[model samples]
Target: MTAPTLRGAAAFVQQVRAAEQHLSGADPVMAAVIERHGPCTLGATRRDPFHTLCASIISQQLSSKAADTIQARLMAGIGAGRRITPPLLLAASHEELRGYGLSTAKARWLRALGEAAAAGTLDFRALGRLDDEAAIAVLDALPGIGRWTAEMFLMFALNRIDLFAMDDVGLRRGVAMLYNRGRPLSDARTLKITRRWAPYRTIASWYLWRVADPVNEIWV
Candidate 1:
């Protein structure tokens, strides 16, 4: 499926609202969560899933500031964002990426992503066709990509409504605090409780992340 345009996305929002209503009727948890959290922001993106996924991998395990800096360096390395193709990424030496502040593992993982894309093993165009689980399975097959990464891909790149990154520490912590629990929410427990949110789990997860941001003193 082609990426959603701004107009198309508005339509999708309407569709989601309808789905939310239906799902809410079936499951009150979903209705309540949607009422609290509203819509999940699917940012406007001209880039395809390939670029989005590549960016996400580059951002992994790094602070947002560090990720932005590395991304800028890599963009400079490629000369222009337009040249950030699979071959260019594959051709970029490990030393080159390291020079741009990438760890050895991150460079290797990026190369794997490039190689998979080049080999037709990672098809950005076909990503929309796959169900959430299948899409995640395909992504996790790559090096350096874990469930969190796959879940991020589903939530952001795929604009999947039902997906949530349960393994995210920030989300777990946020949810734990939200419900006024003394212990942090375990992944298994998060899954069980999240059943109520159903199709809007991603939106709920976003709020949870915001609520957990230490710099903002949200949890306090």
Candidate 2:
């Protein structure tokens, strides 16, 4: 099987800078966000498709810190010098998976993913050729993955530029804080604001994540 092409971390940063230049020119509100945050520092991890999907599954509806802990525990149990593959998860009983702090639903999803992988139903490589919406549809069809999770997979996993997930609470909060004085916008209004960030919305979304950070000082 051909390995998925992975970019060096530097390449992703270069893309961010390029995106920032466009964003700065296109939207002043976003320009302020860029000025405050400086460069986009969204790290590019070279995780394989299955591993990335597994992490995404683990992260669903959970806070980042909690999700990381659960993912770490499960990975540790998979043993040293081993990758997460179909059989490894297929061999894991649901009870064993739950012991790693996965909810019953998440554990079932993981096993379902394993089953799909083993059956050659979910072809990670094939996803590379599909357009964003198409790829998202395929992933969304999977038992537990939702539109938000699929959007995240495209943004973080595949590193597709220009993806925006309006339903994400953080992105919504970021949009509200920046453009609406911390008042939430309806999805339609939010979409209007995000449209100007297009073709670089992924990078824009990265800054939104920063703008919505509670620890960051309020924007003037």
Q: What lDDT would candidate 2 get against the real structure?
A: 0.81
Off by over 4 Å in 2: 1-13, 80-83, 214-220
lDDT of candidate model 1 versus the reference: 0.71
Q: Could you give candidate 2's per-residue lDDT for residues 60-113 as a string of tens digits? A: 888778987898889887652345787888888999999999999999999999
For all candidates in order, the CA lDDT equals 0.71, 0.81
Residue 154 error, candidate 1, Å: 1.1
